[model samples]
Target: MAFREGGAIGTALGFYLIVVSILSIGIGPDLAILSKIAPGVLWGTLLLSALLSVDRIFHNDYEDGTLEVIALGPLPLELVAVAKATAHWISTAIPLVLMAPVLGMFLNLPAHGFWVLVVSMLAGTPAVSFLGAVGAGLTLGLGRGGQLLSLLILPLYIPVLIFGISTMDAVLVGPGSFSTSFAILAALSLATVVLTPFAAAAALRMNLQ
Candidate 1:
């Protein structure tokens, strides 16, 4: 409700799309340079875009006391955490994934790398939402803790960024190369998705206590 009412979902999507579009233009029509950097630029933009929306994961609910009621309800707080993170991924990350191919084309990304980009993003971005939930939970009462949330969350995202780009970079070498990176990225996302809900639930419990 808060995300819809506040337009945060649209803002994050629009912001990253425009930023990537501007980057594609600002870098000029040099396909060689754009293609060379496309993986890094696109992945970085996705990370930043996810960061902008993560704060809202728990902020409004926490403020309005809904989170406390949810905590006391039959649904476990950990499951609530998972649900919020999943909703964030659907609302925020999926749009980014859809736009990535078109943005990749705009940056003159190689056809081979295009599918790799989409696959890597699909595999890796769920971690952003899951981990961001922990960050948002930790910073719940900080009063506009978006900046602090980014600081707390961005470091944890480093592995995702590294492997996400490596997935594309390794594509130039051989199938085995990108596959290995994508596997690690998938592992990371899976681990975060499985574990961070508990962590976030703990954090929310601390805040509530």
Candidate 2:
């Protein structure tokens, strides 16, 4: 509603199409084709869906004064940045989780992979949000920051997205060794967990001034 009310019609539409297509995938004569295509489409949907909300973080809050108070707060600006970015992620990615059953239906994903998608998104979206914070921080006050934010964030997120979807795909394959990909996703998320706060806080502080 906010996305629509805010008038970013194109983005809202993209979000809708993604949700619809993922949910509406038919499951009948194309079981083999579905298995082959499911992993890529599921992964692609996650990436595209997440990208929609990254720019709104700093861009919206910066316009208001909330970002300033947060930057100047005593609890360490980076920590605040991490928290803020996480909140942004929650807003965007949680909805995707709720929508996962739809994507799962299309893939005919097993019960195990169904839960895996949930866990992977949980592990994965933090990387997206925080790294996006870096991009957002860099472009916090710029005239055309959204596209630049994508350029900055997409590279950082590839590994996170890959490992996450890879885990799901691996599950689809021969007995699925998810530990390795899962570990990489965890590592990436953890690394971002450590670093993005400070980076985002710096961007917030810079924008504040």
Candidate 3:
């Protein structure tokens, strides 16, 4: 409701599609090279797309005092953080994950790599959401922290981005490499899922106090 109420849904989608469209055009009509760089380009764009709304994760709730109420709820704040991140993922990242294959077409992705792309994104995007929660919590109530959030969070996003692209690249190498890369990507997601909620909740408490 906050996302729709604030009109950020359009902003997030626009930022994502526009960045992707530009990259597709800038790379020109060369399908071969496009295929070579597609994974990185797509991953990079997804990073930026996720960044577009990271600040919004806690901004509205913090502004309207819902966060403090959430803090006082019977549920642990860490779980609240998880809920926030989960909402962001469902609203923002999942759409991108679903659209990746269509966007992959612009990059001339091979038929085999399409499923790899989808699987890699499925494993990686949850990390993006979870990590963004930490950043959002840290920067809570900073009306202008979108840029700062990007700076603070982009570094943390590197591992997911690297492994996500590698997961796709692994497709060309064989089953072993593919599984290895995908496993690492899954591990990253699991780690963030387990750890970031606590970190984000702590940050929220700091701001609340």
RMSD of 1: 2.0
lDDT of 2: 0.71
* Comparing 1 and 3 on lDDT, the stronger one: 1
Clashing pairs in 2: 78-197
In terms of lDDT, the poorest run of 10 residues in model 1 is 1-10
Off by over 4 Å in 2: 1-29, 110-112
Kindly state the number of residue pairs that clash in model 2.
1
> Model 1, 69-176: lDDT tens per residue?
887889998988988899898888989888888888888888988788888999999999999999999999787788889889999999999999888888954545
Please give the CA lDDT of all the candidate structures.
Answer: 0.88, 0.71, 0.85
Task: Give each model a TM-score.
Answer: 0.93, 0.82, 0.94
* Clashes found in each candidate (C-alpha, N, C closer than 3 A): 0, 1, 0
Off by over 4 Å in 1: 1-6, 173-176
Looking at model 2, report the run of 10 residues with the lowest lDDT sum.
Answer: 1-10
